[model samples]
Target: MLIAQVTDIHLGFDPDNPAEFNRKRLDQVLRHLNEIRPRPDMLLVTGDIVDRGDAESYRRLSVALGQVNFPVWPCLGNHDQRENFAKWFPEIPFVDGFCQYEVEAGPLRLLVLDTLDEGRHGGAFCEVRAAWLNARLAEQTDRPTVIVMHHPPVEVGIEWMNTDPAEPWVDVFRQCIKGKSQIISVICGHLHRAITCQWEGTTIAICPSTAPQVALDLTPIDAEAPDNRSMIIADPPAFALHWWNGSQLVTHFDNADEHVMLAKFDKGMQPLVRSLMKERPGAE
Candidate 1:
């Protein structure tokens, strides 16, 4: 199964504007996905669909997402308002103050977790959310499962971007994921950059933002001090593709504007091309 992951759109940020930078970036992503040779089975918008918790923001978000041909599953981020998100996406099921849902595609089971602790930059699962996650994990022990959330459960070595007050909630999240061999990978967003980590014996991947990217700075500095330092890069919108090959999950980061097919095929590539043609049948 192929899943396209886009995150941190921050739509409706400019309420009065006809075109917002973030919304344009999102459109580019959608157009790129639609133009792909083989489209993804589903699209996962990790979170931060809107910058503020406003009704108009949610409405704009709904309209933007409506352009996609594939199914989209969204989670809430810190900047998101749960009530507004619910108002926009009434089809999604929420339980115990979490927007949690389960999707079964072939042999893969995707578990979407809501870690948005409204009005905060970090995240929390709480006791109820943990119990719900545990129950979900238990129910699908035999199936290969992938967990998707807005905030990553593990710190990615960047001190400032690390989860603030990362004590109790991080520990709780860790304990819930431990000893779960069936969880092939954990996908997340919210840092606004692409990152990977290992926590509780599972692979954790953080997708890049569809808007401007966060600059990669590992230095510890004052959070409030305006040192003329920023972690945002004005680069093209990016996303991640998670491929479930029935046994393991492999993730590839795609920069849509930077894709180029190199013409460097070697003699050894002929056999592989023949094999692919045989498998595809119709390919010449």
Candidate 2:
């Protein structure tokens, strides 16, 4: 099973201009996904699908996503407006008036969670959403599952972008699936950078955004600290691919930009490749 992710598209960043930068970035990534061999079995667009959460933006989102050949699943992000989003994605399932659902794909049970706390910039796993998740996890015990969401529960060290670990909702979310060993990983977005770590005994992976990315800064910053540094970068658009090779799940990050190929497996490199490959411990 293969799962690809693109996030924080923020379409309509330039509401009046059709030639918006984010739109181009999204198109580049979509074009790349369409051309990949054995393309992803499913694509996960993990939140902030548009900027204002308006009807027009969602309409544009639908049109762009219509070109994708694989099954595309989207979850709610902080910037998303439930009512407006529902107008375009009326087919999306809702539980307790929140965007939440489950999907099964090739031995993987994906539990898509809704962490959107409308009118706020951070995330929340409120009581209602958490209850729905608890039920979903209880439904299937033996299946390998993955949790998909927008804002990652863990702090990624970007001060302004980080969610406090002590938040009440964060603790409540942890209690729901703390010891559920069936969960293989938690795939998320919103940070706009590729980050991987272990939390609650499962791998937590954050996919990079299709639009500009959050600058990587690990230093401590407080309210009194200076704030003149750049926050967003014009780096190449990227996505994450989760590959399940039977026993375990592995993730890979890739950018959509095309760069000149400086090397290839031509005749000169063939012998070296053969020699290295044959030397593997599992080689027969």
The top-ranked prediction according to TM-score is: 2
For candidate 2, the 10 contiguous residues with the lowest summed lDDT are 219-228
Residue 101 displacement in candidate 1 (angstroms)? 1.5
Clashes of each: 1, 0
Best by lDDT: 2
Q: Give one digit per residue, the lDDT tens place, for model 2 in 1-284.
A: 88889999999889899899999999999999998987899999999999988989999999999999999999989888999999999998998899999988888999999999898898898888888999989988899999999988898899889989998888988998899999999999999999999999999999999999999988777778777787899999999999999988899998998878998999989999999999999986
Local lDDT at 49 for model 2: 92
The collision pairs in model 1 are 215-231
At residue 154, give the lDDT of candidate 1. Answer: 73
lDDT of candidate 1?
0.86
Candidate 1, residues 1-284: lDDT per residue as tens digits? Answer: 88999999998778788788888899999988877867899999999889987989899889988988889999988889999889889999999768988987667889999888888888878888889899999997878889989988776656777875456888888888889999889999988888887778899899999988888877777868767777678978999998887678899998768557675467878888778778875765
Q: Give the Å error, residue 164, model 1.
A: 4.9
Which stretches of model 2 miss by more than 4 angstroms?
224-226, 281-284
